[model samples]
Target: MTGSFAVTKHAEGAGVIRLAVRGEIDDEVSDALAGIVANAAAQPGVTALVIDLEKVRFLAAAGISALLEGRAATLQHGCSYQVVNARGVVHGVLATTGLLSLFQTTIRRTAAHR
Candidate 1:
């Protein structure tokens, strides 16, 4: 319950960074997430950051704060940030915090071609 989650990064477009997150995002993973976002922001030509949370099972307050901070950093660097495919408890946290509308979220469906 206190273990760290894994986050993977991928380049979607010319200036977009897509991050896929798996497992729980609590206090234990907040620092790691912050670091990951920082690193992504540091990349040259990254104009947008998108976090895919389809596989995320849990997200705590610390995780939410980290994401908000990341968004601020992205904005300061002239970049946009978003979170996608949030469900269950993760969706509840964002909705309750009024952050659901703050981010550009998209629903993802499994692809049969995969």
Candidate 2:
């Protein structure tokens, strides 16, 4: 797993908040992810929260937990939740944990495809 990690928030359209996550999502950075998602969901006028994992190279158990927490927070706030660009290890982890079916997902073209 890479040492670097970042989650950048972007406001898209009227009521959509997109969080683009980069690098490894391990124990060290899981809490930050949860907090960011919760905050984004709690914001006024936010109708949906989108988490982008295109650049995520790894996802630990804690990271999965964080994603679940984010989903809960979004639901509690009456907002829709979605996860996008989950590929490679990140995609496998979510699928094996049965979380892939829990959230809405859309296929994204990777750099190689683009």
Candidate maximizing TM-score: 2
lDDT, each prediction: 0.84, 0.89
Candidate 1: what lDDT? 0.84
lDDT per residue as tens, model 2, 44-79: 999999899998999999999899999999999999
Query: lDDT by residue for model 1 over 1-114, one digit each (tens)?
Result: 655478888887789888889989888888888878878987899999998888899989999988887787778788888888999999988888888889876675433215
List ranges where model 2 is wrong by over 4 Å.
1-3, 109-114
Query: In candidate 2, what residue range of length 10 has the lowest lDDT sum?
Result: 105-114
Q: What TM-score goes with each of the models? A: 0.89, 0.90
